[model samples]
Target: MLRSGISIISVACLLLFAPIAPSLAAIAPPLNLAHSPITQLSVPMALFSFSGSRPNYLGIEDGKLSPCPGTPNCVSSQSDDAEHGIAPLKYNNSPEQAIAELKQIIGNMKGTEIISDRADYLYVEFTSSLMGFVDDVEFYINPEQNVVEVRSASRLGESDMGVNRKRVEAIRAELNKLEAQEAQA
Candidate 1:
C-alpha cells in the first residue's frame, strides 16, 4: 500500500513540475560584459587626398559626417548617411563643371550612368569588384581635385571591405592621374 501511495505522489509531482521545466530551460543567460572577452578592432577609413596645389577634404560621399548647411555643430556620421543613398558634397567645387569634366573623362562608357547632378557633386553608377564580389558601385566626384570617392555599405563592414575600398580608391586614383596627365598634355 505504501509503495502504491509513493508512486502516485511521484507521478503527481512530475505532472506539476514538467510544464515549468521547459520555461526555466528557455531562460537566456544574463549578459555579463565583465566576464566576456574584449578587444578593439579598427575599420579603416577610405583615405584619399585630392591632388591640387592644396589638398582639400575628401568628404565622405555618404551623408554621414557632413556639416549642416548653416548649423556647423549639427552633423551626422557616415553609418547613418550611407543607408539613405545620399551623397553629400565633400569639396567646395562647382557641380556643373565637375559633371562636364566627368563626362569628358568617362567618354561614352556603356555600363556607367550618372544618377544625380546637383551643386558641386555628381553621383555615378557602375559595376565593379567589391570585397571579392562584383557589386554595383556608386560614388561622387569632386571637380576641384578631380577625385572620385566610392560610397558603399561595404565601406562600413569590418571584413575585407577596407581592402575593397582600397581597390576602388586605386581605380579612382588611376583615373585622376590619367585626367591630370590629359590636362597637362
Candidate 2:
C-alpha cells in the first residue's frame, strides 16, 4: 500500500509540473543573425582620443608636445586646450572658507581645479579614478546652514560601470544625509 501511495504521489507531482515544461521550452528562437545582421557598426572610443582625458604630467620639448609614455593616443603636436573646461560650482561663503571646507571633505587629493564659484554652487574638476577619464564634481553648499551637497558624473568603460555608478550614488546619498544632519545641528 505504501509503494502504491508513493507511486500515486509521484504521478500527481509529474502531472502538476508537466504543463510548465513546455512553457519553459518555448523560448524564442535564437536571434536571426543571418536574416538581419548589424553590419554597420560604429564604436565610439572617445577615451582613446587625447582630448578625452588630460594627463597630470605634460612634457614639451623643442617646440614639440610630448605626453608621458603609456598615455593613450598622445599627440605630439596638439594644443593644451583640446578639451572643454569644467566650471566649478559656487558657494555662498567666502571663497577662502569654502575652499577649506571643500579640501577637508575630499582629502589628500591631487589634480583638482576650481573652475567657478558663486553664492550657491562650486564647480570642480578632478582626475577620475579611471585611467583616462576625468570627472566633474559640482558642490552646492548653504553657508548659513553649514550644509554641503556634491554631485559628480563619471565617464567609464563598458565593463561593470553600472555597479560603480551605484556605489558612487550610495556615497552621494550618505553625504546628503550628513549634510542634512549638519544643517539640523
Candidate 3:
C-alpha cells in the first residue's frame, strides 16, 4: 500500500510540474553558430547580398521626410496613412544639437552603418544580425516644425515583422531619455 501511495504522489508531482518545464526550455539561448556544425552549414545560405543598388530616396523633399512605400514593411513620420504613419521626434534643443544627439544614438546601436551625415539630414542602414537583411533608415531635422522626421524601410521584403517600426520607436524612446537626462544636467 505504501509503494502504491508513493507512486500516486510522484505522478501528482509530475502532473503539476510538466507544464512549467516547456516554458523554461523556451527561454534557453539559441545555439551558437560558431560551435555548431548544423548552424555553420546554414549560415552561408542565409547571408543575403546587400548591394547598394537601391536609389537614395532619403533627403528632405518639400520640407518633409519621404513617404513610406505602399508595402506594410515601411513606416514614416510624414506618411498620411495611419498604417504607415509614426509621430516625428520632437526636440527641445536646436536642430543642430538634436541631429548631433541622434547621430550619437544611432552610432551606439548594433548592426547599423551611417551612410550619409548632412547638416540637416542623416541616412543609416541597419542590417539584421541573423539573416543579414538590410533596412534603410533616414532622419531629417525639420527645423520649421521643431521635430525630426524619420523613415525606415526594408530593402527586399514585403513584410518585415514590424522591425522597421519597432526600430524607430526604440530610437524615439532612447532619444527622449537622452533629452530628459540633458534637461536634468
In terms of TM-score, the best-performing candidate is: 3
The clash numbers for all candidates, in the given order, read 4, 8, 0
User: Stretches of candidate 3 above 4 Å error?
Assistant: 1-52
TM-score of each: 0.32, 0.32, 0.73
For candidate 3, the 10 contiguous residues with the lowest summed lDDT are: 42-51
TM-score of candidate 2 on Cα atoms, chains taken together: 0.32
Residue 177 CA displacement from its true place in model 2, Å? 15
Scored by CA lDDT, what does every candidate get? 0.40, 0.44, 0.81
Look at candidate 3 and tell me the lDDT of residue 31.
Answer: 59
List all candidate RMSDs to the true structure: 21.9, 20.4, 12.2
- What lDDT tens digits, residue by residue, belong to model 3 across residues 1-185? 23324365765666687679688678987656777676644334223355345556667778876677789999998888988998998988898898899999998998888998988888998887545788888898888889988999988868988999999999999989998899899
Candidate 1 vs. true structure, TM-score: 0.32
Q: TM-score ranking from best to worst?
A: 3, 2, 1
| Local accuracy of candidate 2 as per-residue lDDT tens digits, 31-83 | 55555556455534321222255333332234222321232212111223332
Candidate 1 per-residue C-alpha lDDT over 67-175 given as tens digits, one digit per residue, 9 for 90 to 100: 3222121212222433222323232335555556555544454334465555544444442321122223344554545434444322122343343344344444555
Candidate 3: lDDT over CA atoms? 0.81
